[model samples]
Each structure stands twice: as structure tokens, then as C-alpha cells.
Target: MFHVAALGELLIDFTPVGLSNAKNPIFEQNPGGAPANVLALVSKLGKKTAFLGMVGQDQFGLFLKEVLEKNNINVSGLKISEKFQTTLAFVHLDKSGDRTFSFYRNLGADMMLNASDVNYEVIKEAKIFHFGSVSMTEEPVRAASIKAAMFATENGSIISFDPNYRPLLWSSVEEAKKIIGIGVKLADILKVSEEELELITGKIDVAVGADMLFREGVKVVLVTLGKRGCYYKYTGGEGYVDGYAVNAIDTTGAGDAFLGAFLYQICDMKMDELCGLNKNDFKRIIDFSNAAGALATTRTGAIPALPSIDEIHNIRLTR
Candidate 1:
């Protein structure tokens, strides 16, 4: 059985390279899409993962499928659509390694994934069902994603969600919040950026925002704090862990890496063991994940930046 089954977009991220002699900027194509990136890290850590999403029948789509297979994730659940071309995002990274995107997706193939295209068998077979908010921005894909999540839950799979919010993807903040809130309610475990927490809850304090999620039936809420590490909260417990020191080159998939590492620990444990975890047990997981996130930022690209399990352990050993 697959350890995780993820359903979402598979798009290209065009990152800035440099300006030419003529003063025109160049870009390098990198494969990215939040759910794909997360599963890449999980698969990198030796977990069996499968991807479920539609991609255009184009060269870029073919390349993304190859990249996922190369990353050790199963591609059997991937679908190809003839109606829309592959989606593209022009990524701009500021001095702090923060990124913004300009998406070219007027009817992207990812947005065309209908409920009929969903892999119900894959969701039923997986131990964890993962998804992101990006696919919820449109129809058909939104219906497919929600259907998969429901099937996974019915089959006893843990639902994992990441609100990897890119403001540019949505038409309005209020609508975005409403849709993303639907994802929050469906998840057992959630990963959100500090900004995403505020966006979803309209609260500045992490604890208060996390509490809002807890009331939504979310069991564990993890708030990513970038370089400061992460803040985590669960029933009767909560704490912050500092990330390891690293000269980050890019922060693209760092959060994904952190989340994957944390979920890896969950996949390793029995449901009973997970239920028995206390505050101290959570601290160990957070520390390990923080190191993994730090290591990912020290490199470039999402899949390429993912560190090995041994590498993450070594970081903890050396520290």
C-alpha cells in the first residue's frame, strides 16, 4: 500500500537566473506544485507515495511526470488532459529568498481534473491522504480533490493538508479564506505558514490562530516560522522549536521538507502510538523536521533540495 496519496497540481516554476548583457532577465525552469513537492520529500525518505492529478499532454507535463518517478513517487495515478496546456508560474525571489508568482493558467490541466479522474483505489490504499489549497481555487479539480479526501477518510486514512497559500492564485482574500477553510475542516493534520495562519484566522498570535483551527476538528496544527523554525499545537500540548543554522540558498521546498519529515515519523508509528504522544514526544519530531527544513533551504529546487534521512540525522548528531 502507498504510504501517502497526494492530489494536486504539477506545474513548472520559472525562477530568475540573471540579467543578460542586453539587460534582460533569464529564468530557469524548476518542477513545483505544493502537493508534489511534499510527496517528493516523503518518497525521498523511502516512503511509498503516489500522485493524483491531471497534467496537459505537453512536454512540460511529460517532464514533470518523469521528475516525480525519478523522485521515487508512483505515477500510475497521474492523468493527462488534452483540453488545457500545462500550467506555468513565473517565480520572483527577493533578497530574503521569499518568492512571488505570476501564474499562466487560464484553464490549466490541473484545473480540469474532474471527479471521474480521481483515483479512489489509491486513496483507499494509502495510509495518508495529502492535498493543498491550490487545487481548491477552481472547479472540477476542487470536486475531485474533495472527493478523494472523503474517500480516504472513509477508508481510515489520515487526512493531511497544507495551505501553501500564494495570494496571486485567488481572486479575493475573502473567497480564498472561505475555500481554504473548507480544506482546514477536512484535515486531521495541517501545515500553515505564519502568514497563512493569520490569513485563515485573522489573528496575529500563533496560539490564537491555531486554536481557531483546533475548533475546526483539526487534531494537530503546525505553524511554520521560516528561519525561526516552527510552532506546533495539539490537544493538551504546544511548543516552538528553533531551526538549525544554514545559509539558505532557496526556501522553495523547505516547508515541504519539514512537513514530510514530520509525517514520516507519523507513518512510522502505529495509530495507538500516535495517540499516546505527549509534549516531549512532539518536541523530538519537531527538532528533526526543523533540521530537515534547514537542510532543504541550503540547496536549490524542490525535489533536488530534499535531503536524505541519513543526512537529516547527521545534522542532529553534529549539532
Candidate 2:
């Protein structure tokens, strides 16, 4: 059985490389999409992972499949679409390594995934099923994602949700809130950025926001605070873990790497044991995840930037 199975977008990210002699920007293609990035890191950590999504029968799509295979992620559920081209996102980065995105996804292949295209057996065999808000922005794919999540939970797989919201992808804030809330209620493990927490809960305080998520049916809430660290709250325990210091050149996949690392560590743990984890147990997990995230930021691409087990261990050792 796969340790993690993720259903969502798998697209090409055109990240900024540098300027040409004519002062025009140059871009490098990278395999990204929050769910895919998370699986890549988990597979890199030697976990069995699978991806369920649609991509165009194009160069970019083929390249993404190859990347997933290289990372050892099973792609039996990945479908090829002849109707639409692969989705593309141009990532703009400031000096601080923070990023903004411009997407080319009008009727993208990823948005065309139908419920029938999903392989329920993958979800049935997975220990955890992961997803994000990106796939919920459109039609067929949106319905497909929900179906997969429901099937997964019914099969006793843990539901992991990440509200990796991009404002440009949504029609309105209200719509985003409404649809994302569905995933919130379905999630057993919810990972959100600090801004996302405030968006969902309308509260600035981490403690209050986390409490609100707990009420929304999330059993665990992980709030990422870039550079500073992360805050986590579960049914019986809560605390913050400081991030690792690094000369970060890009922050594109940092959060995905963090979540991937966290899930990788706990994939084999039973639900009761997971909920029973004390402060020290969480501290070790978060420390390792924080290091993975910090290390991811040190490089330019998502999957390529993910740190190895040795690298993560070295970073953690220094702490």
C-alpha cells in the first residue's frame, strides 16, 4: 500500500531564473503543484507515494510524469488529457525570495479531470490522502477531488488538506471561503499558512484561529510562519517550533516540503497514537520538517530543492 496518495493539479512552474543581457527575464521549468511537491518530498524520504491527477499529453505533461517517476512516486492514477494543454504558472520572486504567481490555466488539463478518471483503489490502499484548494477552483476536477477524498476517508485513510489558496485562481473571496470550507470539514489534518488561517477563521491570534479550525472538524492544525517557524495544535497538545536558518534563494516549495516531511514521519503511526503524541514527539517531527522547509528555500526549484534525509538530519543535528 502507498503511504500517501495525493489528488490534485500537477503543472509546470516557470520560475524566474535571471535576466538576459537585454534585461528580459529568463524562466526555468520546474515540476510543481502543491500536492505533487508534497509527494515528491515524501517519496524522496523513501516513502511509497502515488499521484492522482490529469495532465495534457504534451511535453510539459510528459516531463512531469518523468519527474514523478524519478522521485519514485507511483503515477498509475495520472491521466493524460487530449482536450487541453498543460497548465503553466510563472513565478515572480523578489529579493527576499518571496514569490507571486501568474497562471495560464484557462480550461487547463488539470481542471478537466472527471470523477470517473480517479482510481479509487489507490486511495483505498493509501495510509493518507492529501489534497489542496487549487483543484477545487474548477468543475470536473473539483467534483473528482471531493469524490476521491470521500472514498479515501471511508477506506480509513487520513485526510490531509492544505489550503494553498491563490487569489488569482478564485472568482471571489466568498467563493474561495465557501469551497475551501468543504475541505476543512473533511480534513483530519489541516496545514495552513499564517495568512490562510486568518482567512478561514477571521482571527489574527494563532491560538484563536487554531481553536476555530478544531471546531470546524480538523483534528490537527499546522500553521507555517515563514522564517520564524511553525505553530501546531492537536486535540491534547499545542506548541511552536522554530525554523532552521538558511540563505534562502527561493521560497516556492518550502511549505510543501514542510508538510511532506511532517506527513512522512507520521504515515505509519496509528490515529490514536498520533493523537496521543506528547510535546516531545511533536517537537522532533516539527524540527525535522522545519529543516526540510528551510533547506528547500535554499535552492531555486521545488522537487529539485528538496533535501535528502542526510541533509535534513545534519540541519537538525545543529539545533
The best candidate by TM-score is: 2
List the pairs of residues colliding in candidate 1.
none
Worst 10 residues of 1 by lDDT: 267-276
**Over the stretch 92-121, how does candidate 2's per-residue lDDT look in tens digits?**
999999999999999999999999999998
lDDT of 1 by residue, 1-319 (tens): 9998899999998877789899998888899898898899889888899999988899999999999989989988899887789999887778877777899999999999999988788887799889998999989898888888988889989899998887878889998899998899899999999899999999999989998888878988999998898998887588798889888878888888898888887986655466568888888999999989989888767777889988999999976
Q: What lDDT does each candidate get?
A: 0.88, 0.94
Each model's backbone clash number: 0, 0
TM-score of 2: 0.99
What's the TM-score of each model vs. the native?
0.96, 0.99
Residue pairs that clash (backbone atoms under 3 angstroms), model 2:
none
Question: Relative to the unseen true structure, what is the C-alpha lDDT of residue 316 in candidate 1, on a scale of 0 to 100?
Answer: 95
